[model samples]
Target: MLSPRFQGLKIIVSDSAMRELFKLGKDMHDVLEVLESGYDAPRKRKAGTIERWLDKGKKTVNAIIALDYNETMQEECWVLVHFGKFARNKK
Candidate 1:
């Protein structure tokens, strides 16, 4: 449910991701902050989901957001596909 500051960019949060956000231990507000700030960097087309360290705190949250541009609107479309926390070792 987050929108980009730039009008040219259209970001969408998947329904499944939204439902699982609580597991990330971060509220929507915090996610918006990190995502908005990430806009400063250039986003490229992505398909393969990969976990990247979010530049928010001490590298805690790992999220995968795929990017694809819409030719009709000529705008960048970002979709937050998935996210999760680091797992602790269990013995």
Candidate 2:
């Protein structure tokens, strides 16, 4: 189950990320679900970069997001930069 706290969080997806999702035949709702329920941790890519991992059936999906804490909105905004099936040491 997704937490109620996530209900107010704003989600933003980049154009490239959207294209990747379309190419992978993945749904935005599924990605949002992952963001809402997955375990998240800070990434070394940048100061605000975060990596969210979600287990779907037997596979794990990873979403890289840039988090912004908005004072006016009083909510955390997530900008999805990349997302795909978890690949270990592909680079």
Candidate 3:
């Protein structure tokens, strides 16, 4: 089941998406890294951006986005990424 906040995301769990995630060296650490980076960036990180980081594959990115939207996991802090750089936004 998915949360109401994530219901808006039309994310589907597909085999190919899962396979691609495995192919991209995905793990709890990597997912957490992406999540942390995604959440701790100023530029409203989109699903596409995270996908790009995940080996530049659309499926990989979508998977991460889905996990994030579903709140299966969350970032420890929030920040912003601007012009390809990260900046801490919280004290």
Candidate 4:
């Protein structure tokens, strides 16, 4: 059983994607923590979730791109992971 703190996270992921991303490798929570800390640490701590930070990061990255600015691949990956479209290829 997960803590009530994590209950808010339940709806963040779809059933299928949650199953896929929840177990087999990187825990989504940990990933969200990392990304959230990178972008917004204090706010993340308050919300007890990283979803908003991830959304902000995505918006920031897109804004940068839209402005015809350059961002590193690493920067783009932050937004991509939340999307669940491309899973990291196991090597």
TM-score of candidate 3 versus the correct structure, residues matched by position: 0.29
Q: On a 0 to 100 scale, what is the lDDT of residue 84 in model 1? A: 55
What range of 10 consecutive residues in model 4 has the weakest lDDT sum?
Answer: 61-70
- Name the candidate that leads on lDDT: 2
Displacement of the residue 78 alpha carbon in candidate 1, Å? 0.3
Return the top candidate by TM-score. Answer: 2
> What RMSD, rounded to one decimal, does every model reach?
6.2, 5.2, 12.1, 15.2
Displacement of residue 85 (Cα, Å) in model 3 is: 17
Per-residue accuracy of model 1 over 1-91 as CA lDDT, tens digit each: 4455323446566787776686666655565555544433234434533334445444445455667666766877766676555543345
TM-score for each predicted model, relative to the true structure: 0.50, 0.63, 0.29, 0.26
| TM-score of candidate 2 versus the correct structure, residues matched by position | 0.63
lDDT of 4 by residue, 13-54 (tens): 335544545454545554444344434423322222233333
lDDT on C-alpha atoms for all candidate structures:
0.55, 0.73, 0.35, 0.31
Ranking by TM-score: 2, 1, 3, 4
Residue 57 lDDT, candidate 4, scale 0-100: 29
Error (Å) of candidate 4 at residue 90 is 22
* Arranged by lDDT, best first: 2, 1, 3, 4
Tens digits of per-residue lDDT, candidate 2, 1-91, equal 4422334666677799999788888867878777778987445567767777887776678878787776766878877789888544434
Of candidates 4 and 2, the better by TM-score: 2
